[model samples]
Target chain A: MLSAEHITVRYGRLTAVEDLSFRLREGEWLMLAGPNGAGKSSLIEAAARGVPCEGTFRWQGEDLRSLKPALLARRIGFLSQKNQVTYAYTVEEVVSLGRYAYRAGLFSGRDGDGGAAVERALEMTGLTALREASMLTLSGGETQRVFLAQVFAQEPRVLVLDEPANHLDLNYQKQIFSLIRRWLDQPGRAVLSVVHDLSLARRFGTHALLMDHGKGIARGPIDEVMTPELLRRVYGMDVHGWMRELLAPW
Target chain B: MTETRTLRRERFTPLTCLALTAALLLTMILCICVGSVRVSFSDTVTALWNGAFGLPIPEGIARNIILRVRLPRVLCVALCGAALSLCGAAMQGLLRNPLAEGSTLGVSSGAALGAILAVATGFTLPGFSFGGSMVLAMIFAFGSLVMILSLAWALDRSLETGSIILIGVIFTMFSSALISLIITFASDHTRTLSFWTMGSFSGVSYPHAGALGAALFLFGGVLLRFSPELNALSFGEDNARHIGVNVRRVKLILLITVSALIGVCVSIAGTVSFVGLIMPHIARMLVGPNHRRLLPASLFSGAIFLLLADLTARTLLSPIELPIGVVTSIVGAAAFVVIFYRTRKVRR
Candidate 1:
């Protein structure tokens, strides 16, 4: 289980995320939804320890601040929205980099299980066919899958993905969400993903948090968070008929 | 069959590097043997062996030239080459820029300025008897270190790799102008200072060879030890830090190592250009950017390249004996042009 208590993130003097608190139980699937600059990304980044924040976060019973980066990486796999790899590393090589925190140094070559782990990750992400391909040559959707494979290789307890569905098409997005759902179904696993598409979030997310102006507007089960009143209040869109049409299947 | 072919190709890289290293070493020995006074290879070998064994060989012109003059000069050339190349590789990794080299970072100029000051001051104390060359070398090396640190501090926010190169160029220009001004004012030492600026290994002695060799070995060892950290830094500092690398500390250590390496080379052999710039790039192209392979390959290839360049500089014009710097610049420029054209075509 992971919990954030009253987190505040400020960039210079401007508050990017203010007084945000949430908790995710084991095997839970949570989605963060907001418009551009709604502080969804900032909140996730703060939680991932990529940005500095004034708050107390705990994974299990231990303070998140006390854990070293390598230990933190072992417990939680973070996938940033900006996934730019500068080198011409092979797909397998790129994925293998996730094992960096697990290894002693960059070139220790001591982990005998590395090859097996890489193979398993490639199989899970359906990237076995592109394993030998250069990361520089991959398409956007394929690259995202490769990055997902990297995080999967870490075998972390919690997966934190910031805007994981940005460059993906509808089919690829569905594939990704299904993968996340399957991952969360495993024992002692949890997932927190930032998502934009309301329909997809409605279908996939077990719980949702809606943010507006650097503060949470609503947080609960998906049904409660996706109501017409809340949608109108947060997005200022007349989604009454749209909500009815969207929630019909659910 | 394909597996066998891949294995064969993989085996060839190390084999090729070894072969080149041996060939260059042999050529350097041969060049030393055959100077203005023609000493046969057999005679040269005998004199060298006899000298090594402390045998009472015939005291003549051949022995005198080989023992006192040619040996130290050849050793100095090899050491300078290796040191410059090592510095280049480290700079490239630290800056995370492919074009980054010792010269590109104003390290050579900084060292040069130090050497010039050492020469100008003519300061000779009981402990420091080497005069301006040694003092200037130390000063120049430290100057480069300061420049790199200041650049790192100033560009803390964005940390664009190109800004480092631009700053390096600015420093290089300033140092060169100051060196020129110094040369213009010096009386009888003007010719000597000018010769040093052009960079020659003609008059190297045992002490010069030993100093350069020691500095190169120490600094290069430190660089090789941190190859893993270098590989991590290539992904950018933020990513490296996220993966638990001490980015700032590593950068400072690398700066000091490269500065010291380049400093010793400039003080001993003057300012031999382009070996530091071109050798590491060639190594990267061959070894595919992994510093583990790239560092050693660059070191050996650089030494060989310089030894040959020095040989050509000495023998090409025969009696005239052109400066090694001129030869290196001409060769480096031509090779760079060819590489640029090929890369452009491939990209197109």
Candidate 2:
């Protein structure tokens, strides 16, 4: 279990996320839903330790702050919204970076376990065919999948994703959702994802947190927290009927 | 996909690096052979071997030129070139900018200011007669680097590439202004300062070469060991950190190492410009951007490049040697234009 309480993230004077709290248990997917500038990314960033925040992140009754970064990275994988690799490295080489914490030295050839992890990540992301392609030359959707493969190769117990579906096409987006679903089926795994699409979140999230302008408005089971009343109050619109019609196709 | 395969085929291998090293060694021999007094190739090799083993050769001008004049100069050129090239490669990797070089961060200018101060005030250690000026130059080199790093740190922003480079360029301008101020006031030493500013390998001796070669070996080893980290950093600092690399620690180490390298090169060769800037790009064209191969290839190519430049500087006008900085600047500027055009064309 990962427990975070009263997490406040501040950038200088402006508070990006304030008085946020959430508990993520194993085998759960907690989808963060909010409008633009609603502090979802900041909250997820704080949880990932990507930014400084006033909070306690405890993993299995141990304070996460006490763990070394390498050890923490092995337990939790953080994938940011921006995933641009400026170099012309091939997909295989980029994915191999995910195994850095496990590797011994610079010249130590990738051992059996590292190679297997990279291969598994590539296969899972359906990128085995494009493994040899240069990352600089890949399409935006393919690039997103490539980075996803990189995070997957870390093989962490908890995945913190910030807008992981950005720049992905419809097919890859669906594939990403299903992949997250399959990953959550594992016994000791959890996910904290920031996503915009309500339909996809409704289909996948077991729990949800709704935020508006740096404050959490509601938090509970997915169906209860995502009611039209809360949605209209947060989004400043009555979208109940429109969402129903749009989600009807699913 | 097939294009990637072809690129892979062209990718640098150990054999390629070995061939480059061999070519460098051959070039060194040839550079030693061609000078104001042209020694034959066979005579040059024999005299160099005899000098290396401390065996006495015929007491003639050939032996004296090979051992005293050509040998030390060639070794100094090679060591300084290799050091600067490695520094350039590491700086570019650390900054994630292809244009980054030893002088880009104002280290060379800082060292130049230090050397000018030493010359003007006649700064000298009483007991230690040799290389007092060099020690001061290195101190100022390190000082300027610390200034740049601290400025970046104080900005309260993450050490993003753009911010660091911007700070570095500002520091470069600041140091260059200081150096010009120093040069403006000193009348008697103005000539010396100007000559030093324009870099040369004319008066270098064996001890200077040894010191540079040793420093390069020690620091170059450390830089090479960070190849995997560099590979990660090429993606971006955040990406590297997400993969468990301590980005701050890696950047600090690389910055310090590259600064030390630029300091030593500037102290020895008096701010030989553009070898560091252009050699790595040429090496990357031949080899891929992978540092494991790029490092060695760049080192060898840099040595070859400077040794040839020195030879040309000596022989271009048989009696009056041109300053080595002129040759390197000319070659470097032309190469930069070609590289810039090609890169832009590729992007388009």
Candidate 3:
């Protein structure tokens, strides 16, 4: 399990994430929910040790900082919102990079074959058929899937997704979410993702942590934290009623 | 149609490298024949064979032309080509930008400035052959590269490709301006320095060729070892970092290694632009983007390109001797335009 206690992120005098806390356990899909500028990303980035923050962020029992970057990479695979790939790397080549942590050394040999793990990741993301296809030729959704497969090939115990579905169409979103769902079915695995879509958080997440103005307003079971009353209070609107109102004509 | 698809799909193989090597040797022999005093191919080869093994001299043009002048110049140009191309590929891979070659990145410009300084001041580090200017060139190359990269980072945190290349160009101009200032003050050395900046291998002797060859092997091997890291970095630094590439460390090592290789080249010759810039794209088109294969492919291709370019330089107006940099710059500028648009196309 990965957990953060009273983590706060600040840029100069302005605090982006103010003492927010959350923990992710095995088999749990924890949705980090918030409206715009709610510090959801700041919290996730802070926990991932990508930003300056003050708090206790632990992986299992050890301080996450105590682990070497390469060691920590093996434990948690991060799927950032964007991966800039301008070169003509094939699908297989991109995925094999997930094994970088395993094969990295200053004078390591040229035997950089990721082999079975790369293949499995490709299969899991339904990219095996396009293994030789260049990343340049892939569509937005396929490109996203390629990146997902890359992290999956890393074989991490915990997956940290930063809006994995952003810029993706609805069907692709469902497909990506379903792939992650299946991944979580495996033993000794957990998921923590920043999600803005409340419906997705409610549907796929077993627990929810809602934030407003850099403050965690609620944290508990998905049903408890994502309730209409709390959601309206945080978002300053009738969350469920407004969504239904927009969908009525459709 | 099949040829296009085959070219698209083909991975650079060891067979391709071997074939290029053979072609490079043949071209070099043929190129050696086409100089001011045209020696026949058979005589050129005989001269090379006899000269290489220290056999008894066969008098006339064959001996002096093959052994003394043409051989060393060809070898120097070829080594410079390989080093420039390899450094270009490494820079492109590290920065993930086609525009990130030595000249555009100000590394070569800085080396040129250093060489010009050595020439103007009559400064040469003792206890080294071609050591004074080249040593200074290497130092300045590293210095300029660090300056350009830091300036780029300061301008933009994300280090967008366009912004970085812009900084490099500005720095190159700045350095060139400084070089002109030095040449203006010491007008007597103007012609030597001007022709030198245009980049010709006329000045390269056997010792310079030997030094360039040595640097090629040393720095090239160091670069080749980082191919995997370079591959990871080509995608982006964050992805590289997440996958456990010490991006900072790898960038630093690659920067120093490439700058040294380029510095050695510029000091020995002049700013031989575009051998590094244009050759990688050609090699990449044929071989794909696996740096392991691409680096060697670029090396062979660059060597061949420079040999041909040098041949054209001397033969195009035989005895007039156009600067080799002129040839590379013409091709490189056009390629830069095409790449600039293509990168824009990708953006849309």
- Give the alpha carbon lDDT tens digit for every residue of A75-185 in model 1: 888876666554455686656656656777643542455556667788999998897787767877888888788788777889888888887888888888888888788
In model 2, where do residues sit more than 4 Å from their true spots? A105-112, A244-250, B1-14, B59-61, B123-132, B142-173, B187-196, B338-348
Candidate 1 CAPRI level: acceptable
Considering every candidate listed, which one attains the maximal lDDT?
3
lDDT tens readout by residue for model 2, B1-348: 433443344346567767887898899999888987888888888898887898878665488788888889999999998888888887777766676676656678788778777766778777644366667777888788778767876784555544655786787677767777777787576335545556898888988888798889888888988877887888777788888888878888887777777776777778787787798888877666777667777888888888998898889998999999889888887875676566555455
User: Taking chain A by itself, what TM-score does each prediction score?
Assistant: 0.92, 0.93, 0.96
Candidate 3 off by > 4 Å: A109-113, B1-12, B57-61, B187-191
Candidate 3 residue pairs in clash (backbone atoms < 3 Å): none
Docking class for candidate 3: acceptable
- Candidate 3 per-residue lDDT over residues B167-270, each given as its tens digit: 98888889889888888898785445555567888867888988999999999999988888899999888788777777778889999999999989998888
TM-score of each: 0.82, 0.90, 0.93
* A51-161 per-residue lDDT for model 2 (tens digits): 899978888879887876667778888887787565567798888778877766555634447767888899988999998788878887788888888888888899888
Q: What digit string (tens of lDDT, one per residue) describes model 1 on residues B17-67?
A: 678778777877787776677787877788878989999877564777888
lDDT of 1 at B281: 83
Q: What is the lDDT of candidate 3?
A: 0.86
Tell me the DockQ of each model, to 2 decimals: 0.29, 0.45, 0.49
